[model samples]
Target: MSIPALDAQGVRGPAPAAAPRATTPRRSRPAHAPGRVKVWQRWVSPLAALAVWQIASTTGLLPQSLLASPSTIAVTAAGLISDGTLPAAIAVSLQRVAAGFLLGGITGILLALAAGLSRAGENAVDPLMQMLRALPFFGLIPLFILWFGIGETPKVALVALAVSFPLYLNTFAGIRGVDGKLAELARTLKLGRAALVRHIVLPGALPQTLVGLRQSLGVAWLALIVAEQVNADAGLGFMINDAREFLRTDVIVVGLLVYSALGLLTDALVRLMERRALTWRRGFLGE
Candidate 1:
């Protein structure tokens, strides 16, 4: 028996060949799409600059007397490392930096807290702070030398002075910028002063405080460098000066690069801290 074709019936019309199902187009991702990390892209500029620098130095397009090549700097750094001089200097410099940073940071945060939280405190502390901040930190070098001598005290003091102002300003601003609504809410909730500060004040101020920390750290480095350069028995700056006296451009470049690397490293550390601290923050990371 032969089956009858459905097309013969106008009601069915062979079901119209099931009509081709429409397909969704595959989408091309945007360049900045999250989770797409192009790690190599980050190095392109630095590597290109290095290539240009190497070429310039080797081909005599740039004078070596002025600019040392990366390779030469690397070799010089290795020599310094072998002699243990660089490590010793690094340790001393880092010690001074740490001491200064701690002193400055503590002083700044405390003052900021006192002033930001109370009008009386502000009246007492803010004027002196503002006045001192107006004075160039480097200019204090001569006075510090006279008072503290060319010892570690002056260097540490300078670094502390340098670190304090940024922290103080940022912390004060951050605390003051906390939403008044939150304060009122805390009052409404009958929260104690301590509780209000713990829950509402500090957390809210963290973003700006971190920014201040970064600035303060940069200042600490700057102050250390300037102080060490001015009069130092030992430090990275001392090495640079010694290298300068001997016309060891390579060594000078090495010390300079080391300083740059330290700055970058410290900045990176703060950035890492920021990421961890602000994980609750909503932004491009979607966190």
Candidate 2:
């Protein structure tokens, strides 16, 4: 018997329709790397610029006497390294910066905390701090030399000045910016002063404090450079100054390079510390 065509009325169908094929699974593209190109790009521009400078100096487009080539600078730096003078200078400069930055940053934070927490403290201290901040740090250089006499004392004092204001301002701002509601809640709960600060205030203030710390570190380094260069001293800054006097532009360039590299390294260290200290701050920019 032959099969009849299927219809609405009813008849035998040829066969059931085959099930539709499923679509091929989509393949995901690989994830793009974060901050990769930025790393290379930052270096590329500087290297290219240095190459152009080297070419200009080599071709006499810039006079050798006025602008030293990279190779000459490298050689001069190598000589200093071999003789150990550069290393010693760097060590001394770093020591002064460390001592002063620690002392100043700590004191500033304490004072700022006091001023921010108590109206009486603010009234007594903030005015003097403002005045002190307004005075150019370098202006005190002469007095420091007079009192401390061209020793490490002057260098340390200068760095301290540089470090203090940033820390104080930032700490004060952070403390004051703490949420009033939290304070009220703490009071309602009958939390002790220490408990209130430890739980509520410090965590809230940490991000701003880190920012101030980074800024203070930069200022400290800058101050160290200037302080180390002045009067009867040895440092990267002094090396640069001395090189300029003799027109050893190569050595001067080397000194400058060292200063730049050291600044970058220290900044990187601070960022690493920040990342570790503020684990909760991840996924948020500027935290």
Task: State which candidate has the highest lDDT.
Answer: 1
Give Cα-based local distance difference scores for all models: 0.86, 0.80
* Model 1 C-alpha lDDT per residue in residues 15-134, reported as the tens digit of each score: 333233213222223212322343566678999999999999999997778888888888888989999999999999999999999999999999998988889999999999999999
Model 2: lowest-lDDT 10 consecutive positions: 12-21
lDDT, candidate 1, equals 0.86
- The C-alpha TM-scores of every prediction are 0.81, 0.81
Kindly give the stretch of ten consecutive residues in candidate 1 with the minimal lDDT sum.
1-10
- The Cα error of candidate 2 at residue 15, in Å, is 49
Write model 2 residue lDDT over 34-125, tens digit each, in one string: 23454577798899999999899888897767878988888878999999989987887788889999989998999888898799999987
- Model 1 residue 74 lDDT? 86
The reply for model 2, stretches above 4 Å from the true place, is 1-45, 283-287
- Total clashes in model 2, counting residue pairs 3 or more apart in sequence or in different chains: 0
